[model samples]
Target: MYRFRPRVLVDVSNIDMSTSMLGYPISAPIMIAPTAMHKLAHPKGEIATAKAAAACNTIMIVSFMSTCTIEEVASSCNAVRFLQIYVYKRRDVTAQIVKRAEKAGFKAIVLTVDVPRLGRREADIKNKMISPQLKNFEGLVSTEVRPNEGSGVEAFASSAFDASLSWKDIEWLRSITKLPILVKGLLTREDALKAVEAGVDGIVVSNHGARQLDYSPATITVLEEVVHAVKGRIPVLLDGGVRRGTDVFKALALGAQAVLIGRPIVYGLAAKGEDGVKKVIDMLKNEFEITMALSGCPTIDDVTRNHVRTENERIKSML
Candidate 1:
């Protein structure tokens, strides 16, 4: 899905992956995507992930549905963290959580705009999976599964997520906090423009891990379109199917400020808890550094559009 033009004559030493996102300096452009129920992977859960992120000097976006509370995750370590929020059916609930995130020192509010309803995750359905007790809402709200629902998560999402959520809510969220609001789940140039018009601080081009819409285009395919639409108005981020350093390099070349990894971190946590998570992050960083070197990019800024080609471009050249 990607092609790179390497510069063998260029210096390969001193490659720097350090970059800043929303005013926070990170050691690398790689960040941990907000995935739910870390407890499902390890007993330490988000607490362990937070520690790993801090150790790596990267950002960690905490899920609203996290097994650990915002406060607990914040206090876990010194990592720069953002909170991913899903608007609940109750406006008050959304506001309360935003306030809590701000108070807990979360750097941004990653407002997920994709899921008005839960997606048909057949795997979860076959397993009859139930979500862990959403610890963020532990004392504040209680969500129970209705009888005969395929999974507890589905039932909870159906009852809790506000289907009527719209562009106007961006203004509502702005009125509540001064923290940067990054809108996630945009896959089109049209919606990307709308997000900028709505005054979001950033945009995350994602497909909810391809779990929401069955036939949606891959995030990488649409990333450049969304980036061109925004035209550097805000930081454009991508999160989906980024499994390698080359993937991250490809994303940056196409115009993403950074990329996020979800399932890999989960797998790492399950394998070795905090240490495992740290290892995963370290491996990605090392691989990306190697990629940058091979591609003749001594710095993150050097990884530009000229470094890579897309399938369409490749086909055009051959023709």
Candidate 2:
């Protein structure tokens, strides 16, 4: 569902994929999205992931449910990192986590907004998977449930996520931290406008990896809508189903300041630890650069809306 108009007369030898987010300079626009319990993927867990991100000179968003503590992950590498938080039913717990992240040098807080209740992941249910103890919250709080029937992740989310979460909490989060805040899990133009009005530093267009709600529009499909509603006032990022460099290019053209890769990083870590992660990043970087050159973009700035067309646009043209 991607269409690009190629230009043959452009320089292909030099292309820059570097871009800034939240005033931090990253080597490329690609970044690691927050995935919980990385220890399931590798022995070193988030520590290995952190080291890889540092080596690649990109950002990594550490999940609040990470297998490693914020301090442990921060100590593993000096990579620019963000912390993804699910506001717990307990406000104090949320505040403490934010404080720990800020103190540990996280540059931003990615507040996931879509999950008030854990979505039914049928695969996890069928596999009878149990989430590992969240290292970040270990000893600070207990999410232990009384022998749940489904995955521990579902149980934990059900117990911890504040079902009463509302827009006013955004201001409360802003008050508690000096770090920039990005509201993740928004997919609509109306919500995008609301996020901007709520004074978030950025917005992430996501559908909880389409695990939260079935039949939701793909992130790429709604990226332009959110971007348009934001009106250039704040950065809009996208996550979900980005496995190829062409996918990255498509998201960027539609107005994602950058895209986040979730499953690929996990797959890489599970396959070969830190080196695998670096390899995955390197592959994406190379392919994205090639995409840039082939599409007539010599730099990230050169990649604009005109560089690509959506399925709707193509169909309209035919009509």
Candidate 3:
């Protein structure tokens, strides 16, 4: 039997999604994840996204290979910004980026550990997608050699990736940044505990937005274990496949301190620059607030394992 829709407007009286990330207060815990090639999405690139973040009163994690430089985006908006660094073969090059981020007043350093090698994307490859040669790098690095000169994005990723990195380098990174350092790819409980023990500020429960390992479990599935491993030692954030406000509610219920939104925001930016991104953020926030109210969750703490059920029997039992 199908029930008729409620005639009255749904009341979102219980929406209180405010939270903090690295001591910075956000209107909500939702954040914009760092992705490469903002120029592909909008003419203003990171500047546009930064503006959206400012408008929504959210945070933005700017990628290392961004078309726009860190200073450019930082100056354009006062949105809480974190620098996402891709560890390279040359330690000095990595150090330069960290120093630059520090000078640019980035509040945190997000080290992406998932991509020891860049994963293959069929669309980018078939299109022969050479990312319109990073315009910002002109006076920076020698543009003589593009990241990929041959086959596709995958081949480019293969050559550009640095698999030789080790955890020991985290200490080296800590030495460079008084700003909080967050490891952005810890998935397993063991790695989560390691991050906690490393004395790092936080961990982002991620699978590189599922762009790295195609078959890896969705980020939401592994979030609880990571949160349990941290055991309140530090914050744990989720980033990947987050497309709606309900996704935020689900993530909060599963113990994610916050969630990071990616590609969708880019699409929004592509559609209409800053205003479009703001609308996307607004849509998610409104949906999350409504979901929390409908589910009888009035605050972040009101959301918990009790509000969630899983098809996985063992997992359901544990919850």
Candidate 4:
């Protein structure tokens, strides 16, 4: 949906893709987005993904529904990790997991605000897709309702998730943990502003991978709006539909602090192991570096809004 405005002869000899999020320096602006049931993708699950993130010198947001227990993933590697969560119906259930995450050395909490209820996935409905029991809530809560239904995700969310969750709960979460807080699943400038007003440390502009609400605006298309709304008060990140090196550059040009990868790395994990995951990251990093060199952006800060042109801008030029 966007094109680059490359600058020629910009001394492309050295390019650096490194950037930091909430004061932690990472090797690049690419972070691993939370995707659940890594074991279903590979036997190693989140453990392998954690190790891979450490190897890549980036962060991985562990899914609230991860198959690997928080403690297991925490002990598996020294990668900087953030825990993504959904507020459960049982208040203490969510509180206890957040406490465990903090005690286990997690750096931040990414509260997923989009899925108070599960979305309509026709494929899941057709094939009877079942959500694996979450290892994080093993003793605190259960997802073992009737067991045979493919709509287990629906069953679990209805029973465990608090659809009543709202902005006021941000204060409730902050009361329990000293870690920085980031609210994910916000797609509009309005909610983006609310996240900042709610005292969130960062905001992730996402549409739940376009799986939560169909025909929702693509995350990339709406990224600039959220970024503009935040007005640099907090770091704004984007996830969904990010599949290429150019995609990363496009997000940076539009004002994203970073871009998170979801499916590609998981595909890597399912195909090989940790090495496969690393390979996917390496390829993206390499391609992004080339994009930087070609586009006259030798550093992350060098990428600016002027470096890209949206279709609307192109049409406006004709006028």
| lDDT of candidates 1 onward, in order | 0.92, 0.90, 0.81, 0.92
Model 3 misplacement above 4 A: 1-14, 139-152, 312-319
Tens-digit lDDT track for model 4 on 1-319?
A: 7889999989879898999999998999999999988999899999999999999999999998899999999999989999999998899999999999999999999999999888987787667666766888778877755447566667777888899999999999999999999999999989998999999999999998899998899999999999999999999999999888999999999999999999998999999989999999999999999999999988999999999997899899899
State the lDDT of candidate 3 residue by residue for 59-169, as single tens digits: 899988788987898899788899998776766667777897889888999999888877776666666666555644555444233434343555545655578777887
Per-residue alpha-carbon lDDT of candidate 1 for residues 1-319, written as tens digits (9 for 90 to 100): 7789777878877888999998899999999999998998999999999999999999999999898888999888899999999999888888999999999899999999999998999887877777766877876667656447577778788888999999999999999999999999999999999999999999999999999998999999999999999999999999999999999999999999999999999999999999999999999999999999999999999989988886798889898
Reference-based lDDT, residue 41, model 4: 88
Between prediction 2 and prediction 3, which has the larger lDDT?
Answer: 2
- Clash tally, candidates in order: 0, 0, 0, 0
Model 1: weakest 10-residue lDDT segment is 140-149
Candidate 2 lDDT, 191-244, residue by residue in tens: 998899899999999998899998999999899999999989999999999998
lDDT of 4: 0.92
The estimated TM-scores of all candidates read 0.97, 0.97, 0.89, 0.97
Model 4: runs farther than 4 Å from truth?
147-150
Candidate 2 minimal-lDDT segment of 10 residues: 143-152
